[model samples]
Target: MAQTDTPGEHASVLRLPGIVLGVGLGGFADGILLHQLLQWHHMLTSTDQDRIGVKYYDPDTVPGLRMNTVWDGIFHTVCWLAVLTGLAILYARVTQDRRRVWTSRVLWGWMLVGWGLFNLVEGVLDHHVLGIHHVYAGDGQLWWDLAFLLMGALLVGGALLLQRGGRPLALPAGAPGPDAR
Candidate 1:
């Protein structure tokens, strides 16, 4: 038998929000903990700073690197952009598809997948092999890197679980019925 797909099946209302939330949080962690709190080196390099050794110096004693806060601003800007875009998409979906409200599971699942991928790639390339940076290079940085990897694994695993569980809530009104077109 040929199966007919419904709007719910084709439309993903939570996908954009999930991406936004994940990216926003990741940027937040990088800006707050890595940049502000622990004071690690920024990833974005400019021309002037590139000429000097600011990119590869200890955060504590590097004067040229200390004043360079452009990366921090850029990080926050990107985070806000992601979040705003997500919000816009979510709002549009909610208004347009008044019949069926999106499920939290879908949103969370999206976030998990996005975050997991980010963590996995960043951890492997930056933390493991390149050794260009670590979460906390001052004391027990290796352990921190390991923990970061573990966190990434957990996020991916949790997302898999959510995907397996599927949607637990009943479909909203006006949405296609379980047995209807």
Candidate 2:
């Protein structure tokens, strides 16, 4: 990345806040689209025990639906916290740096990278390592999980392409500060 003489310009180009926001937003997308909209799977729909084998929750049942709803709420809470934290970091970065560019290619690229990271991490940890839940909480779970990772990889690759050749947009003169925005 090119750097200006001023330290704030360089700092503004870091794009860490954008990345964080992307990750958190990506998580929200997953939770909202996949979990709620499509009704694919819940947080704890597919459960496996050491000796008791595997069990699947019936969404039709009141108790089962309640359990799934609770878990889903927990998942939503985590995603919400991530977004709020990311917004806080972004506010700090933008306000602290005078020359911070709000609409930079690097920032958008990094945000895409963050979303990719969210997908990769969540897919690996939740779907494989922890085996708590998956994209499709039933047989052939591995294929669906692998597909999620592949999509994440695509997002990262796309971000790299976007970041390759673009100049950062300067913040508008006389623009209201982050407090107003």
Candidate 3:
């Protein structure tokens, strides 16, 4: 039988929609709060330190800041696309009882899982692997970066625990939704 033939067997996979949503939302939070409001860091802010020799775009200079702003816009666009895609997937997967699904621990857990994954991947790849930027990129920057990773770990672990108590969602287990594939 194909994967869609057994919803029960793939019940956990339903988290995909929530995860995608979380990735976008979490990214928005990061960009809005950190990049805009806090002025903490911008895209390519630390490219001067990049391991791969990316041209640095210093946020302190007009030309540099312009470049960083453009890159930030690109980042936000990607996040926006992720959110749109996530919503489309969610609409297809949950054909009924969306209110309950929205309130369910499972959905929230999956969302947290997505957020955590974002932090983990971004923190590691951007902060550590890519040498792009630190969380604060100043005194005690490593501490902030480490803290970010720690928060991600905690979120993922806590979300998994929370999801354990959730009842299985009332999706059409036998009947595939539009996203059955």
Q: Which is the leading candidate under TM-score?
A: 3
Candidate 2 C-alpha lDDT tens digits along 1-181: 2232333343344457767878888888998998899988787665652123446565668987888888889888887887787778766656544344454556667678889999999998878776767898668878999999999999989986765544533345533222111
TM-score of each: 0.65, 0.76, 0.87
lDDT of 1 by residue, 123-146 (tens): 776666665556665478678878
Worst lDDT 10-window in candidate 2: 172-181
Top model number, lDDT: 3
Error of 2 at 137 (Å): 3.0
Each candidate's clash count: 0, 0, 0
Residue 146, candidate 2: alpha-carbon lDDT: 99
Question: Model 1 — which ten-residue stretch has the worst lDDT?
Answer: 44-53
Mark the regions of model 2 whose C-alpha exceeds 4 Å error after superposition. Answer: 1-14, 49-58, 96-102, 169-181
TM-score of candidate 3 relative to the true fold: 0.87
Which wins on lDDT, candidate 2 or candidate 3? 3
Could you give me the TM-score of model 2 versus the true structure?
A: 0.76
Please list the Cα RMSD from the true structure of every candidate, rounded to 1 decimal place.
5.9, 5.2, 4.1
